[model samples]
Target: PVAAASIGQVYKAVLRADASPTGERMTVAVKCQRPNILETVTLDLLTIRGVVDFFCTVPGEGNKKLRQDAQGLLAVLDLAATRFLEELDYLQEAANGARFEREMNAVPVMRDVVKVPSVLLDYSSRYVITQEWVEGVKLTDLEGDPKYANEEGAALRADVVRKLLNAYMVQFLETGFLHADPHPGNFLIQPDGRLCIMDYGMMTEILPDQRLAFVEYMAHLTAGQYSKTLDDLVTLGFVSEELAKDPAKREVVGPVLAQTLSALYAEGGGLDKKVEILDQQAQSRIGEIGDKLEELSKEYPITLPPYFILILRAFGTLEGLGLSTNSDFAILEECFPYIARRLLSDDSPRMRSALRTFIYGGGDRLNVAKVEDLTRGFGSFTNAMEAERKVAVTGEGSLAVRSSATPSGQLDAATKELLELMFAPEGNYVQELIIEEAVRAVDSLSRDALVQVWQRLPGAPPGAL
Candidate 1:
């Protein structure tokens, strides 16, 4: 009753069995895949990819981007075709659902935040999967409601988002099996406030070794160790070993990655307009980056390993979800805890290398970005709030109020609440000063205080204290 997608339609039905836990008849979600969906998807991909190939072949102004990424386009379509075809297998989905149920069981603490419906194996077929029906408020509905837009409301949404993301970290970094598709309709807010996850048609399995490398790559990135991140990326196969070994082969990928990811996770940078800006950059920065890529590929390849594509897609999708929830959820920042836990809690050469890659002790410097972010957020809030007040006093809607903002306004709302917490009875602010600036978090508070006030501040992830 809730959803119909390209692949399937879900209907509410009552399943009957003598050994039913609740009764002889129990409500279940019956997901029936469209007949010959695989064929349909194949034909669609063929049509789209064919057109894309045509553009890549005929050199033109609008086709420049496609031409540049032509080979990659073909590879991605090929890879996607395989994955999309797999999504049509109801039996595989049933198994994926079962696996997720097992994962949920392993971490009982996670029950508060997320859940998986019970699958009825006997009722499942190659084209149809049946599982226990779950009733709850859709995640989008919770965010759409006017009441959940304030500081407290944002905090609640942020908590749920964090829990959901952390669970994903465990899946990708620890369990090695992830629900690759987490589009909005796949989630629900249970009556008791837990997140219910449904639809496991698309899942990614990260090989054990690949998972470790991913963790190392993330750790280095989080610590602002760009040089180390480059090495990790090379070792992870994003770059060819030939390039890593050849100094003559110029590569500016490290700086690009560092700047890109840093900007992405920077305060006030989550979701919101950043995504559009980044997409625009991809199209606009071609002249700047295309030459470097071409030169770099001469000595080495720039191929992304098969599994990495799925992982990256999931990451991007997560950002979209963050945008919807109006929460500042940083993917790399969130990865820190899970990666640290693994390295510190385990013993191995890989773990040692990962720990080593995590750099510490940088020269003290003001994070101008963080300050700029605070200023901008403050400005937006002041402007928006002032507009609202003007409307109330003048009895005229001359200016529009941004009360329904997605990320930009919501971030400021959360920041205002945190500033209240950051201040003390002593009448001074506990501003985030130099993040990793070696400021002692001791009795000497103010003189040592560094403002997290900007996006430039870096240290342990928030709440690590």
Candidate 2:
């Protein structure tokens, strides 16, 4: 079979003539597991558990208590990890794909904005999955392309981001089930400009209560309701009450939380700020806090429900993809509305109590006006596609030669800076820095210089050089 992914392989095949649904020849993409993937997954889980367990037990302030709490917490995590890993089963994947299609069909907006591959359930077997072949280019390839460098391009990119975020929010809050992976490679942009999303081996479902808690947490963050946000986080098991009550412990986490909230409000910022806060520097200082928490968890460790971890991982993947496309894409802004709605519409006693505290305690109100403004912005962005223009396909074997209006403007200064930073002798922090730099360099330098520089960069893909 042809390889399609890191953990699985895909093959292009024709359905048996007699078995054709339409009685016509059809191509299908078949995905199957790579040898030893199960083993690799098992080992990975073990490693994660061991590392988290050991870290929880490390001696430090409150570390002993955290260790005690972590023991039971670890057991719960292990159980969830096992369940998630079991989703790798071909049968489970098929069922999930069917459910996803049903969910997608229920949402009218999703029909236009997102593409869910048509699964060939009858053709699937114990170790294999068959789905319709989707023809398109990966979004990863479009990043920094001159074809997508203009105002229209930026708007299209932004629209796709918004649509994806909206879809996730609705799925998590309304349906409680979601596609857990949003990586670029799993996303395809058709020539006709439709967004095709494939690969559903890792779908997850959230419990209703947990989903409600998550929504409230999101609402609190978006509304700038810090104390409520903290309470919601604790309710969701992302943090513990002890941490919330202890000023010393809170002191350790307080600035990070403030920075995270501030970054959310900053123009052109998003989840990247949270990631930056979690980087090497923060990790070093906060490692002890985490250890202490884990130790404390051994006795009173907060057990995060399975769905919450899945949501966290899903968001993490989405944020990574956003950064990969453009360092400036803000995910939280796209996600705020559904969260706000969840909080405001909630009728549960916990939610009511939280809302009472939020309102009476002078918590910031959900900015309905801001949500309306953002929704308008998103609509404008989507409806504002650039006028159709042709580009010349250069070199021999070129199918056509055409010229349209030359695209205007140079690359942004920040883009240029990022490009230059990639060439630094010291290590660059982000992967693909060198590749991005090469693309920027080509835009800035002479053809010969561009070619020379491109040749020097290792792993410059075919069209890139």
- The model with the greatest TM-score is 1
The local distance difference test score of each candidate is: 0.64, 0.61
> What does candidate 1's lDDT look like per residue over 278-340, in tens digits?
565566554367557666665466677776788888878877666555655556654454554
Candidate 1 residue 350 C-alpha distance from true site, Å: 1.2
The per-residue C-alpha lDDT of model 1 at residue 403 equals 45
Off by over 4 Å in 1: 17-24, 49-68, 108-113, 248-257, 265-294, 297-301, 325-329, 359-465
Which 10-residue window in model 1 sums to the lowest lDDT? 397-406
Off by over 4 Å in 2: 39-80, 144-146, 149-152, 241-260, 264-306, 324-326, 337-465
Q: How do all models score by TM-score?
A: 0.67, 0.63
